[model samples]
Target: MPEEIIDLNSIVSGRQPINSSETPKEVTFDRVHSILYGNSSTKLIYDNAQKYFTKKFDQTYPHTSLQRDLFISIIQKVHPSLKVQFVVEIGSFTGNSASIMGKVLKESYPGSFLLCIDTWLGDLAMWINKAVWEHLSVSEDGRPTVYYQFLTNIIKQNLTTMVLPASMTSIIGARFLQTYRFYPQVIYLDSAHEQGETLIELSLYWNLLRPGGILFGDDWGWSSVRCDLKKFSYMKNLTIEQAGNTWILKKPVN
Candidate 1:
């Protein structure tokens, strides 16, 4: 079999190059708010993330911070089965979220996995926004090289045993949805923010959740994300819990 081709340099540079058209005069309101309100621990992580990845962003990716806390909460609150299997994470950015989940999984289930799925590519919207992409390194196929760096960082953090990288996919890829049919105990969805992609992720992954499993999505109240999740509000037997930009959904164990 051919070795999987990866761009090590791109993985280290988590942001794509910014062009003149992409640069802005100053950071946005969200950026300032994030900086002001960020917890000390979160700020430290963000600082290290910027330095480790050499990437800058217009707005703070608070999803990464929230995801970490929520993931830890889930593990501590829910007792795992002796046969603890898998925790699925869609969109592993810099491995922050996965790393946190892995910590709990490592203690609960010696060899259980944190299976992450992402294309790691900056889409047209990402490029057009000219934000994080400017510092991200992408392969010829468009996957970010920072993915490898994320893996390496997690390993150094002692999370290697609990993390697994699955096949990559664009946020809107139907094939990816079909692939998600392999049910997981917990699924964390945080892919693209476009309406179409978010809807597809919800539809496809919702069913792949095993009984008693939980599904959570980031970017809940954000316009692009909120619009899509709102469509499911009227669905029978489904209730969503809102927390900042995170939305939690459960697959009842009936």
Candidate 2:
């Protein structure tokens, strides 16, 4: 009897191929950075951020230690390569981290970009945390949102070209990309910190990540994150690499 060989390319496609550059590469960072800080001053965006926070929320700009550490850890993990990089960020809040990643893609990995997937609705944790809630904006009629602020941040830094936005749930976004056969070199998950949701997201995005690509994110200190990740790691038979509060998982190169 002859063995049947599978022809994967025979699968149905939803859309025509969209022209894009090749796969991913490495990164870097500096002061007054990531992207689109405008042309006036190096500190223009920072100043604007502070002013915006003070005027709107009556608080300081919210750059935290977790973000700083995440940036550094990502820089360390993604090596310098000439290949074009594709990144998908599942939870973009106010676009600070996305902008930082945009800069990394723009400067270090040329022709690269980051796509942000989020509903812009506050997660359960964010809804419960007062400090996080302070960052959310509401329409006069009463629709709470942080999406506009995220868009503004991306535009303010001129990162629109490098940082694309998709206002949707992570699962839906993942399935959409799967239809296009879109595979990112890096996938960062930071949505709802629930065990079930985290596990499901990790599995969904893991399939969309190209081999050797890294899936990492912050909130490693969250019990839900740690527990779900442990389950995910065990299931995938992949070791977890930790740097500060950031957790990393690399898809096998083969």
Candidate 3:
């Protein structure tokens, strides 16, 4: 196996990144409300999200994948097992949502683990939208290297035991799971919002999801995302549901 191939379990056994002793940086909000708010369409969506985050998430910043209550409720009400033991989270930016999820699974679904895969690099929109890029954790070398901070967040939450970090592309992460014969009961897609990329990711990860598993993601407000999900749902004959900014699709149990 190559160095990039992550041993899913071993990653949580210990964090192998540099400066292990360094204090974890506390994540702050984009209080200025920057993150692509310049675009009229996205601004409208962001403002809408701002309202929900303020009400439900305690006035937290709107840059993360949230809705803790919604996620747990779906598992409890919809999923047959009423528990999620395995989760694969694509695009964990600084582990904000993963921390919430890790904590939830730890308390509600004991013995569960979340494999968080990411490139630790901001998406293209971030680079194009300077305000968005400003929020990322950049290395001294000027690279958007948020991976270490992601580990720190996991450690701070005491989730290293249940939150496995895999720093790589979504495709490689899927391959890693396949190599281990790993199958996830839940797959979270938050990586790319581009229609083409989103479709590819949805199709690629669908194979890794167990029957009756849930495939969900954020950014439903983005036209591209909505279009891609609708197209994918039509192609697969899967029914997609949405509540707030999150969307979900369940694989039929044959």
Candidate 4:
């Protein structure tokens, strides 16, 4: 009997061909690269931003360094040539992801822009979480300052020019885009995680995606997210690919 050995480097480079019976289970280099060095660049920006925000405003951000990197990777994959004009993010919590995307778009696609749609009112969970309320600034009338922090973060990143802030709920924002006939190359959904809301968002914004565009989201492991994505894929007859914790569905080109 001959010994069957797997060449690690060959697998990583996709150079060596595998026999049918010896086919590897997964051959996604993006996932592998993410596991190895995904945080290399984004982490620095996140850490610096975190320190600055904490020192200046005594505040902390919501999204993690991993999420920031993943978002960038998705944007890169969608616009490999850096020719995208518009990218939309459904939830722009604290503006971390939006700032990152804004920087990437500005550098890669000079005229590209990011449209972030969020009410900035911490979700139900955040509203109930005392920790969230403690870090938030209050207005003269006593309303928690969510949108202000988001704006401050964007400004800190110097992304005001590339990132457009749309202060509104997901549904209203999506409808506005639809009514305005705005089509984006990439649509990222990270807002409501509930199954029903997630499904609605998937449906509503899916249409706003240009043909051959990408509609991706985070929290793929969440039961609601996973189930809804599968159902949506089935309904649309599209295939879903998992990149890190994100699930992506590329619209068919007509």
Winner on lDDT (1 vs 2): 2
The parts of candidate 4 lying over 4 Å away from their true place are 1-59, 65-69, 79-82, 133-142
Ordered list by lDDT, greatest first: 3, 2, 4, 1
- Model 3, residue 153: distance off in Å is 1.4
lDDT of each: 0.57, 0.67, 0.67, 0.66
- Candidate 1, residue 202: the lDDT equals 70
Question: Model 2 residue 238 lDDT?
Answer: 83
Backbone clash pairs in model 4 (N, Cα, C under 3 Å; residues 3+ apart or in different chains), count: 0
User: What are the clashing pairs of model 2?
Assistant: 24-85, 36-157, 36-158, 37-157
lDDT of 2 by residue, 1-254 (tens): 11123222232234443333434223222211333233334544434534433323222337332364466456556544414467889988777678777876677766677878888886775677777776767566666657667766776677755676677799888866765566777888878778878877887888777776788887889999999898878766889998777889977867
Q: Write the per-residue lDDT of candidate 4 for residues 1-254, one digit (tens) a residue.
A: 11123221221232232233452323122222233236424432223434433324322665433355666666666634424677888887766667767777777776667878887766665667776655445466776666666766776777755676677788887766654455788888888678867877887788767776789888887899998787777766778999777788877767
What TM-score should be assigned to candidate 4? 0.71
Cα lDDT tens digits for candidate 1, 1-254: 11123221222233333332443323222232243335433452323444434432222333364555667665443334314466678877666677777777787666467767877664455566556564345666765666555655565676644575544663333233333233466788877777766765676566555667777877776787777676654443477787676888766776
Q: Can you give the TM-score per candidate against the true fold?
A: 0.64, 0.73, 0.73, 0.71
How large is the C-alpha RMSD of every model relative to the true structure? 16.4, 8.1, 14.1, 16.5
Question: Which residue pairs show collisions in model 4?
Answer: none
User: Distance from true position, residue 105, model 4, in Å?
Assistant: 0.8
Work out how many backbone clashes candidate 1 has: 12
